[model samples]
Target: MYYIAHRLFAAHDRALGALIARQLAKKAGPESVFLPFCDTDEEDLVAPVKGHRLFELDRERLQTLTGMIAVLHGPSLDDGVCMEIGYAAALNVPVVVVTTDFQTYSADEHSPHWAFPDPLIETIAHRVTRVDRLGAPQLADSPDRFTAFAARNQAQIETAAAMSVEAILELAANNCPAPAPARAEAGTVFLEPSPHIRCPEALLDTLHAAHRSVTIAIRHQAPDPFTAAHADWTTALRAEVLVADVSGPETPPGGAVLIGAAAALRRRIAAHLPTAVITHAHGREPNWRNLMIQYAVGTRVCDAHSLARWLAS
Candidate 1:
């Protein structure tokens, strides 16, 4: 079962945290284990985190925790909780936010969720609630002040067919830790249209951003530079990498390997970002043109674009 952690930075928010925990327990393990780490005890807090263990946020054991939740409902968020959310996010464990007042301005979900919402629309910009205040604030007198988690942050999570289109589909909704919600918004860069659009320079930059691990599928085995650089980084940083090398294109034939890889990783942790590529290593250019392939990094290549567009996108 997946471990979904509930969050209550304040004693006042125990009820919401407990409620979120119960809902998440239903979607358990087929995806991941959600574990909510906290400081207070079950009795002192609003409610108990059933089916999971609770730990103090600043404790050493918290460092060993695989994940955390930044419950959006509370008089105010806790500083420790924010640190845990960001830490877990960097570790690639997945950080899903739970907030009623999600900063989704612009009359559309155009910018990063972390970015401040449009100033004109709602001044409650994406403050990221960094200074986790333990007490309630003078919430805006507007009806926006959430009484309970009337709407989960999931409701605000959006998906679009095209970048310009201002439409969104909610994958899931709740005031709990949602897996890579912000990261998923960054579209998969690999699924571009053209083959010659690759920028190895950019690829290295992306790879370098990987903190915990990177999953790479080298279509036509790209070149040694990408792999070598990644390998060196992984070794030095002690990061893990999962590479599904299409080395034997001669054996499996072109395009076949890519299709299979795409299907396999389709349900992976994420389906966005340019996670795969078809490099010149496939064969000689004049003799054998490189077959176009798409792979997702943080996003799934739902739409087909040229290699250049994929990178540029």
Candidate 2:
């Protein structure tokens, strides 16, 4: 029974309010609404746990209890919610959002904030009717349908819950210090020669010299990409290759084919390479000085940031 706080006070506030109660009641039943009350303020939230009631908690004070419960409504891009969501998300807490008319994406392109499920984005409304969003239509619309929806997307829920709260929070804290323009950690950086500036030119030479057996990893395996992109780099090396492409068949914004190609190539390379990469990510990652910290060299990259690497060559 994890308590939650809804942020929206107007418009879809009712929808979000109903959403919280309905999901909790349906998921863990009565006990789903967990509350350790020490004051009168606590009693007020109980009614909402039973029916379409609103629970009022001082958001500023209860942020400490992030491990116990989760957030229902947030500022989307505000500092506090950003920090809390980053924490709750990494901790894999039960995050139940309550923005009736939810905002899917941010307005500005350079710095944008996306909703949860950067995972569930695959299932949002297509038309975007609003700014930030996914276009996939949902099966359940009412608050009561929340639990069932959670059940269907249990895999997604698990991902959210399994995050290390402390690790993520630490990453957030570290973000305060600006990262350098280019810093390749010892013994794990590679870059293939590019027709254009592509990624880092030195990276390819470093990997080739370090490992007798090398692998090419990219996010895409398109015709001219993984194979073609590395044609020149791999030609001379006798290293075994493993192409790791994770790009989907979906279309990208701005119809930038090269951007998609770059994303694909970088992901594949990151998978098997000890190389830390920050290629431009397709979806919802904040940029730190024109680059996002994407280190996928280890199975998966952390979302601390995103990057746009050169791949023209």
State which candidate has the highest lDDT: 1
lDDT of 2 by residue, 178-245 (tens): 22212223333322221112434344443454452443333222233323324422231222221222
RMSD of each: 19.9, 17.8
- For all candidates, the clash counts are 37, 39
The TM-scores of all predictions, comma-separated, are: 0.28, 0.25
Question: Taking the tens digit of each residue's C-alpha lDDT, what string does model 1 give over 78-186?
Answer: 3233334333333333334444543332223342222212121011111222222223333445356463233323222211011101110121222245333122213
Candidate 1 overall lDDT versus native: 0.29
The C-alpha lDDT values of all candidates are: 0.29, 0.29
Off by over 4 Å in 2: 8-15, 34-83, 94-113, 116-313
